[model samples]
Target: MSLQVPRNGKVCVIGSGVAGLTFSYLLNQLRPDVHIDIYEKQERSGGWLNSHHREVNGSKVMLERGPRTLRGKSDGSIVMIDIMRRLGQLSQVQYVGKKSQANRQFLLNGQGRLVEVPKNWTQFAKFVMDPISGGLVRGMAHDLLHCKRLDRKTYEDESVGQLLARRFGSTEIGDRIISGIYHGIYAGDMNEMSSLHTGRRFVEDEMKYGSFVRGMFSGLGAKPSEILSGELMEYNRSIGGQTQHNWTEFARRVKQSAMLGFAGGLEQYPLALRAYLEKQQQVRLRLGQAVASVLPGTGQNVVVNGVHYDHVRSTLNPSAMAAIFPEIQGLQHGDFKSVSVYIMNVYVPGTNLIRDAIAGFGYLVPQRSSQGDGLLGVIFDSVVERNYLNWQTQLPRHQDDCTKMTLMVGGHYLNKGLHLDLHKCLGHVSNHLGVDLAAYNPVTQNLLARDGIPVFDVGFDKKAARVVEECTRLYAGHVTLGGVGFARGPGVPDVVMHELAAVLHA
Candidate 1:
């Protein structure tokens, strides 16, 4: 099917997140003649993937206030790698050589003491075997691993909490662990989340192995020795340049023809895509142009924009586009709430908080242990090898002198709403590290949209599916939606790229 191009056919893309930028890039690559117009609500693009740097004591320290880490696994990760390679920044990609040793995940006991997460099976057994936590774990394990196979069709829509309580005992341990996982990722409640959507792999693995314990032992160890021996070859062939690409270098490489600014922050990603499209004679970008309504046009699609974009020919899959933009009234607009997080970047004079650079990726604060108002996570800026630091050489500075540390605190509903209480959480963290926050110069505090992430509810999949179907039905052979809403994880770029590739091939 040939894409009909007028004397100057224009392609309008909504949103400037990775998905939108990626789709624009892909479309430009495939049909350069087709004018591409990317409209971003934000003043800039890059979405949540953003970084900042500051000079401290004559040394530069880079702080990743948002999305400090990237994953090496997953198909989406491969797409990000490919984009970097194409942009000629593949060599800049670097991975954490050594995993962080901060396994200090704590669960708040009834008394509110912070206890360390179990280190080994022995510790796990002992912890779960306890009278209080054990019964819960056992019950959960039984429900999760020993329960009869669920009807796959009906299971996809089941609530996580309902599934867990029904399959596993609804004990405190199960509840706490489930809550912790949800809080760590979605910052959401399990009862509102779909078990199949969130825990599909876990459920599959359990059902396949007949028990979580057996699954862990057998599945983890079941890798063939021959395949394990070829790990180096496998790693070398993988995208993102040998899986050694660190977050900073990775971001730098992925950002092509993109401007960076602390003012607009993440908004730059989408704005850049808009700017790029505008630069193209064929492409046009319309800002503040909320798509109020959409309807089927003869052998094409019509989009209602502000005065500037009253009516434009949409060269996209009519059906798919229609699914997303169903009805001219904008009834399909999903409700969303915004969240605000304040990132505190501190520069200590001469302390090397991270002895090993590779081992300082970061740590996550499980929700169950957040204690109402607590910091979400802390990324080791010095440890993540980037241009900000000369990690290859030995540091001449002594530990007692000074060092830089970036403390990321507050974002979830509980933490953001109670920002005043974060001072205590920050104090606790500072005291734990024996570092004085007052001593170091505060680099900067960037407040990001707390509602930055979409909340996927129990029926989100169904709604999203309907949107896709409507878009396909309306636009027919034009238009596509790709982003975190369609996919999840730190490797969102990868997913966008993969989806773009698939659409192109199709």
Candidate 2:
């Protein structure tokens, strides 16, 4: 059946990430009469916010092999919360107040001992007073607290490592911490990464206050309640304790809403948006129908599928579609590479291995330590969030059957060959947890693509600008691009929504 809009024009949207889904939802809400069709190559939705549960050794355990948590305080998180509220799922969103065990985080030094991160003034003093580590810590603290600002134009182009080393002076402690953070976040090497892109917050904070320590102290003193209730405090504690939080419960809550789904991992979010549009009477969705080429068309009629598709009457962007159309010549396609990531969700039975809800958000494997067979990090699901626990009690007993453990393995930056060997990786993780996996019934393994994560090289902004300019020239007013690759993090949906809204209105 051919779908028709009452008065609003017809529109087509491409892709199905959070950016795509949020864009479509906003547009539909704004103009319910507007005909909107969303197309996706995948069949399901919820991009990286995917979760799975299975019976492992007679216990009903949940596992998240992908993004297991959302930054509760991020702008993207705000949008997600609003969306959930609109969908009547906000009540399901629960927060587990500060838990002590979640504070433990460790840095795996060359010696293999997990060095706990400093949590309080006492820990900090101890770390600095140690003769062997004191100089590096002091140097880093001084640099992070007092680095001079550079011109904005040059700031974006600098590598994170260079900026840190310059501000703090290259010391073993500083370098190791920087490398660990880089590994944890981007799964990329710190030395080669653009500081302006990845460490913008740190750099900007330092630029504004002249020191991380000062900024932290100032922030703590001013907004004690907000800061204490937020993830920063949890992160600080993790650093001090030398442990990471498991993100499974957090990820599950995000996906539970009908407005959110993850049929095929995180990639499903975009795909689901496409499906919703296709189901609408005012929308049409096309798939496996790559545009072969695009050419200038005049008046209201442009030939598509051997029939003239009205341009003026339709709300869809003809120019945008033409630009991305496969057949279009003379335009540079965006550079992209397929990345394969391996995930292992391990369930550890018989032990209250994780006590704090925040302790298991998981840890990143530094690039420097990539040579070893060790898994990237382990997330204690049951401990990170109480929502994942089967009981209402604060702590699960060691003999309780409900307790489980989840571990995530190699990422795109890691060697892909190593990931295929799940058994080996599982064994390594079991060793790290001081437990045996054989006791667990079903261990879940998933592999997924990390597509559209922008690679900010030396001149990434220029390259991105050129792509935008070319898109504008070729597609004109038709195609629209939105996603993290365009902008990073939770802020992306807002930026894309505003830009697209302006474009639509114009």
Candidate 3:
């Protein structure tokens, strides 16, 4: 479907998350004549990009209740870097140091002890032989040699758990490793989340190339970089980043290791974008203003908050988006699977608790393990970015080595309705990591995010496609829906790329 760009028409964009903001930025750059007005329900922008930085007593601490890091080593990540440069915020990007321990992450074994996850061949062998691994190595061997592909045709989907158990010859491996990764990102149950969403590219390789092991080498066939380069050029032009692009710069940026974040935190991006957009005469930001309803007319005109616009773009979640436009049909609640999550922030005055405990980027607890408080994972913020703890304005001697951590709670565990109190969470941390909270006089904050993350349940792709199609058919040339949740994958960079492509192509 071809979308006709209006010469000088007004457009209303719902939701002020990264998707909406990036789309607005690109649309404004691509067609400066088009008047853009963004309406955000929240008093502040950055939906899940929440970052809290403050000083308590003499210590500086930062609490990232939402997204914390931006990956800088992939094609999607390069899209974000290009956008940052275009916005003149490239200098603000800070990469994790080359030799930093932040590059490492741990996993909780069945014994409730944190163990460094394998990194290289030697580590992998040791990890496999370890008694704590619980036969995962054997499972991998069976999967690599004997497992056959499922009989599903194109467009058919299966749960991550189903796919793993069928191909890997054991449900234990899925519960241990696969579940932890998905839980960390999507806060989803492997038994329900779609394999298509989690590992679609790899699974597609196995279908055609015979095995996932072989697919890793020959998956993209030949000249895969050629396919990626063409897309990158188109995206670069769409965002006004490069008039004449250099493949060398793109390759260098994509190879850069470590994740990047702003000094203030991830929210800096949206906050800066908001500051930038406020100066534009053609852009209007309506903060704290909710779109009461969306009334689509026969043609290209759509009514939002009693104002008529040529086109409306929705960045809201599936259910919330559907609720606003009651006139549309064929949309249902089951079309989207969103999971609620709770974040507990903790700051201890001394590093004894963290240093003496698990090292690296903290650990993830699998569902099969019995870690009290229903903890999913823990991020060692202080270890990840030690500089965040060193405040410039503070007195020199005031800089004390402190441990700051963000503990993730709930997800599928929310169904249990366990005690989510700060005290209880602290106890869980103490028990799991053997950290003495009382010694450090810990400060804590609880953030409850209801329907915070979108889960890619089985057949989610089909449902997502239907939702988009329904919106198009019901409100042709009137409403365009786009966001991270609707992207092919749910990484921050993935969402940015998806929105950029969708909005530009639209």
Candidate 4:
């Protein structure tokens, strides 16, 4: 897949999110002679990564609209850490402590109360015996020992729910555990999403060894980042001389159980990337300009916005990309699925909440828990970053003592619409936390209207592969597709590795 791009070759990147910017940044560094143009339809270049800070009294209140932190175990974390070091912004990166990673998270039990997730064998046994988690734990155990072999000649796609039911004795495990975690990550429906695409490693493991447990045991010693990239070690080695060693140090840090974020916020990474690109003579950033369509140019060039380019990498969603290049197969409607989620930022009395709340990262609500309006989860921003709320307070009486949280809602409803009201979300949190916000005197609230999270449904493999092949053929090897929407895996690191591969292979 390696191609010798000509000197001074022109490459147009559509979208300036982490994926597009990372592609441009790495490409500029690798082939300094290449001309790059990054076009973003929105005025801001960071895509959905929005962070806001306000000064109350003398203290600072921070709110993250999207992607609060990057998991240390992910390849995306390693990539971002590497980029931070290269950009001279590593010092600005802050990591969450062991408590955030190692401590037990909560799940809303059938009794409408938060319950600590079991950690050790004793806790596991108790959790399994409890009525709330008994069925799920027993079902998962049954599958681990007696699941049937999934023999297939071609890539067979199935939903997380179907796979669990087929392999395990019951689909309760899927409806409870898988759905709870994935809903927060993808905002996807368990019955509709493709297990092959979303949980490929576990699925592939089961396919290879006839049991997912066996596959997990086989790779238990490997670093999570290696597993996340599906083994991109050789590709990393091909890019830079010290890539492997740098990644090794990152893996060590991950083992310490750290979830990383920018001191300012995730938005800083993209802002830094933009600033670096502006200094490059061959780089051009087109903000607030949308690409109407992409067409083929004469010979080997690709055409967009009436200009010819040697290569074009699209980080747009499947539907958006299909609208621009209608000729590409399998990018049409129904091939790709996305769900919109409403995010509410709430501020509660910090000192009391921190001392009284669950004190870990946050809590996830399983579908079986039967919560109102099907809320996905709530993130304890202040708890995750303990220093986020430490500052002087503006009010003479009220010091800087408020816990900040981001409430995520409406992931279960794919077709049905969800009516999101601030008071409603607050009411849910108030009841769940057993705290009355009215007593806090002044409660601050910010809302992120909507953001899309992609879903890979059954039969998505053939269609996704077809789309990639068609794009490559139509552009004559000049167009490479990548992003959270286009990649095999989810999250930031998967997309980073995807574009990294394109530039390296190119």
Arranged by TM-score with the best first, the candidates are: 3, 4, 2, 1
In model 1, the runs with Cα more than 4 Å from the true position are 1-9, 55-59, 98-146, 206-211, 224-298, 304-342, 353-360, 385-420, 431-436, 439-444, 474-477, 488-494
Instruction: In model 3, state the lDDT of residue 161.
Output: 87
- In candidate 1, what are the lDDT values of residues 304-357, reduced to their tens digit? 453222123332222224444665222235432223455655555455543432
Candidates 2 and 3, the one with greater TM-score: 3
Top-TM-score candidate index: 3
Off by over 4 Å in 4: 1-4, 99-103, 152-155, 212-247, 355-357, 387-400, 412-414, 441-451
Which one wins by lDDT: 1 or 3? Answer: 3
Residue 352 of model 1 has an lDDT of 58
Q: What lDDT tens digits, residue by residue, belong to model 2 across residues 362-402?
A: 44444444435535555555555433322123232233534
Of 1 and 4, which scores higher on TM-score?
Answer: 4
Better of 2 and 3 by lDDT: 3
For candidate 3, the lDDT comes to 0.73
Q: Residue 186 of model 2: what lDDT?
A: 50
lDDT of each: 0.49, 0.48, 0.73, 0.73
Q: What TM-score, over all chains together, does every model reach?
A: 0.71, 0.72, 0.90, 0.89
Model 1 lDDT-worst window of ten: 256-265
Q: Against the true structure, what is every candidate's RMSD?
A: 7.6, 9.3, 3.8, 4.3
